[model samples]
Target: MSWTLTEEHLADLARGAALLGTGGGGDPHVGQLLVRQAIREHGPVLVLDPTEVADDALVIPTAQMGAPTVVFEKLPAGTEPVAALRALEYHLDRTADATMPIECGGINSMIPLLVGALTGLPVVDADGMGRAFPELQMETFSVYGVPGSPMAIAGEGGETVVIDTRADNARMEWLARGVTVRLGGVAHIAEYAMSGADVRRTAIPRTLSLALSVGRAIREARQANTDPVARLAEVLADTLYGHLRVLFRGKVVDVERRTEAGFARGRARVAAMGGATGQLELVFQNEHLVALVDGEVRCVVPDLVCVLDAEQAEPITTESLRYGQRVTVVGISTPELMRSPQALATFGPAAFGLPYAFRPVEELVPA
Candidate 1:
């Protein structure tokens, strides 16, 4: 089913996208404000079902690329994504029929929506990654065979750089990352241009709707004085992401974080409450990559490692984590498409340089 995305839905969308972002994908607050501004000016943007898109329609995926922490001081000028889209279209010598998110988590989730509203293009409900990943090539669209080039990156100052890495997706990330660094550690991107048929085949479907639902569920649960984490799990049970496990509940004891190589790299230790034994240690590069409980791997990408405020159930981003905050670490299984051998090689534990093999979160933390 298709729907219109209005400013009214931005809050819930951001909240849910932050959770699915798994502590990466740029800051949700920034993304939400950007989308809200665009929608207020251009009216509600239409969100089309992937099946509704014509086979030959040109679908261009757009997102912001940077360390989430950098976005705090380097706010978008609200024209970057549109600038990137126009540049890419000028390069391809063709207009895009629609815009879609490269990743459905964090600020990237809202970039395409901003583009759609600004340009009067419909937004596709699907995305390249059901959850966020640090690198450009980690998208399922690339893993499933879409080339991520003839891409464009745009800065707040209206500078646009077009890169065509041909068939080398990793090279695209290399070049884009270098350019992003030069552009002051942040830029908006339009890449992985493909036909609607390609989107239907490779894109993670209905993730925007899923995010909105999850966010709304949290809000409604809080209003009703019910357990929001339990509501979040219930809301996710029917989605492509099948399970949500609260692996640890505790107070953040320590956080060692730094911005390096245009990415946020860090470790966070959460100790069990009430003087219980064990600690949940999170190691991340932009997004949470692994969760270790007393040195045992409990959750690893491409599965989600989400940390939520224990009482409010609000998802916390890596850049926002602070010592002494009470957090509930939840692990969510990725969609089946993300668990395939090819997808795993692209973004699994091995891809992140972790020692463990890819394991479903449900199996890792049995109910």
Candidate 2:
């Protein structure tokens, strides 16, 4: 089924995508504002289920590349994504059939939608990562063998570059990161152009709806004066994404954050606020990578480590984590696509340079 994405869906979509972002993926406010403006002017963007496209159709993933912090400070020029998309199509010499998200977290979730709104293209319901990862190579598209180049990147300053990094997406990221830094920290990108058949086979399906449901659940819970965190967990459990567990609930006591190498890198310490007499440490590189409780690993990557507000259930990005704020640490299993051997090799605990092996949230904290 296909439906139009109007101003109404933007807020909820942003909320849920932020949840799936773990602790990073840039902020959604800028994307939301730009998309809302586009929607208002262009009527509504159409979002199609993955099954709706033809087997041979060409799909391009639209996204932004840079430190989330940098983009936050230096807003997009609104034309950057459109510039990237057109540049990509010109290079391919084929008009794109649809737009897809590189990931379903924060700003990424809305970028394709915004592009679709502007281009009259249908945005695919699927995304490369069921959640967000800091690097381009970590996407399931790459794990499933989609080449990351012949990529197009458009800067806010009217500059654009078409990159052909051949088979290495890490190289694509390295090259793109350099461009983004030179662009003064943020630019729009379109890449991993693939066939509809391949997208259906590898992409995490229906995750946009999943993000919407999560955002809606939080809104409804708050409206009813109920437990928004529990509502969010229920929303996740409905998908194959696995259950949610509260790893810790407390007040943040320490934060070590810095923007280095065009990424937000840091660790946050949360001390138990109530009867629980312990503290938890979260390590991140743009996104929260692991959660350690009393010096033991409680949750790690390839799974979600969500840091949400204790009362409002709002997701806290790595850059926003500060001292003395009450927050709840939640964990959920990633989509199966993200847990495959190929994906694990790219993004599992070892990929994050952690010394321990990867463990599912369910195993670390059994139901």
Candidate 3:
């Protein structure tokens, strides 16, 4: 069966996308607004099921690669993803059969929907990384041995780059990041060449549904005057690594950012609330990478770390974490699908320059 995006689905989609983002997918607000705008202007989006795609179909996943901060400021040229997909098609010597989201969190989820509308291709309901991550190679594609390079990157000016290299995923990350920075800190990317069968096997199926469910739960709870965050926690409680922790609730007191090798490396501190009155420091690079309570590491990468407002429970991206803003830090774990050795190597603390050995979030948190 197929699914179509409608005006009614926007709120739930945003809520669910935020939850699935596990606190890293960037903010879903702009994407949700853009999608809602598109629906209002052009009507609902046509979503095709994976089964509807031909077995040998050439499916390409598309996403925005860069600082989520830039996205909110510059606003896409509106033609970047279409241009990226066309560039990939030109290089591949075949038109794409369908386009899927690289992931369902934040802007990446809505990007493919816009691309599908612009290109007249059906948007597949599946996604690569069921959540979001900091780099291009963090998807299931890498876990399944798919090459992230030889991929296409495009800018609003119609300029495009086809990255083909013998280097592994990390090196590809280094090169792609440079290109992204050169393109003014963000560009559209389309990668992961796979047949429908490979996609069904490697991609997380029904992620849009998961996103919708999570979103709907938040909206329903809010309408009922219930605790939205608690309700969201309940929806994901079973699938997540362990009980979610309300790591810290406070107001941002400081922010420090520096550009290192094309990544926005920085840390922000928030003053805690109520019984826990202190500062919580969060280290980040595009995505939140670590959380520390009073200078001690409480949670680090490969475990989900996100910041939300204390009252509303909406996400606040790393770039948006500001001084004097009240927020709550939420910690969840990467799903088992991403806990494999290879997965950990790609995104664990080691990958983010932290020296500590990796441990399951369950072991690190208090019982």
Candidate 4:
């Protein structure tokens, strides 16, 4: 079945995307604004189930590639995402039947929505990555054999470039990263073009609706004055991602962050409540990659490490971390599809240069 997405859904959707983003994917606020304006102008977008797409229909995934911090100072002109899609359609000499998110976290979750609204195309609920990753090739679409180019990248000023990497998705990332950096550190991209059959075979299903549910759960919990993290855990418990665990509760004591090589790289330390005897450390590249408690690995990449305001349960992005804030670190297990040996090689601990081997969050931080 298909559903309509109006302005009413942006807040909850953006909130969920931020949490699912695990501190990366750029902030969803800007994307939210762009989506809202597009919807208000062009009317609500139709969000379709992957099953609703014809097996032969074309689905193009779109997103923004850059350091999350850069989007703060370099706001988009709002036309770039759709422009990238149009450019790709032109290059392929065929129109896309629908658009979908390459990543279902942060701003990337909303980019496809914006494109759909502006272009009058239906938006697919599935995505390449169930969560955000710092690099282009980290997507399951790439891991599962979809070529990432011929792809198009568009800038805020209406500039567009297309690349054909053939079968080297990693090379595609390398080239795109350099181009994104050159475009003042942020740009819109449309890539991983696939048939609906390929989308069903590889894309993570229903993540957009999942994000909306998560956001709504948090909002309702707050309205009822209940524990939002607990509510969040309950919400995810029944989803494809499975279990969630609260890893630590503390006050942030230090943060070191910087934009480099098209990513926001940083680490944050949080002391146990009241500055007590233990500490939790988070290392990240755009998104939370690892969590350590007293130097022992508690959660690792491929799984999700999320930080939320202890009081409001609002997700905190990597760029938003600061000292003196009260937070709860939560870890959610990744789907088994993303944990296979091949997928691990593409985005696991080793891929990020972390010494630890891959471990599921449920195993690493048992509830």
Candidate ranking (lDDT, best to worst) = 4, 1, 2, 3
The best candidate by lDDT is: 4
In angstroms, give how far residue 240 of model 1 lies from its true place: 0.9
What clash pairs does model 3 have?
A: 16-215, 150-163
lDDT of 2 by residue, 1-367 (tens): 7677889988898999999999788888778999999988887988889998899999999999888888768988889988999999999999999999999998999899889989889999999888888888888989989999999999888788999989999999999988888888778999999999999888999888888889899989999999998888777777978689899999999998888777888889999866879989999988889999999988899899999998899988887887899999998998777887889999998887989788888999987
Q: What TM-score should be assigned to candidate 3? A: 0.90
TM-score of 2: 0.98
Residue 331 CA displacement from its true place in model 3, Å: 1.2
lDDT of candidate 1 over 198-271, digit per residue (tens): 99999999999999999999999999999999999898998888899988999999999998778999999999
Shift of residue 281 alpha carbon in model 1, Å: 0.3
Task: Give the winner by lDDT: 1 or 2.
Answer: 1
Instruction: Judge candidate 3 against the unseen true structure and give its global Cα lDDT, from 0 to 1.
Output: 0.76
How many Å off is the CA of 333 in candidate 2?
Answer: 0.5
lDDT of 4 by residue, 1-367 (tens): 7899999999999999999999999999999999999999999999999999999999999899999999999999999998999999999999999999999999999999999999999999999889999999998999899999999999998999998899899999999999899999999999999999999999999999999999999999999999999899899989988889888899999999999999999999999986468899999999999999999988899999999998999999999999999999999988888999999999999999999998898988777
lDDT scores in order: 0.93, 0.89, 0.76, 0.94
lDDT of 1 at 310: 92
TM-scores of the models, in the given order?
A: 0.99, 0.98, 0.90, 0.99
Q: Would you give me the overall lDDT of model 1? A: 0.93
Stretches of candidate 1 above 4 Å error?
none
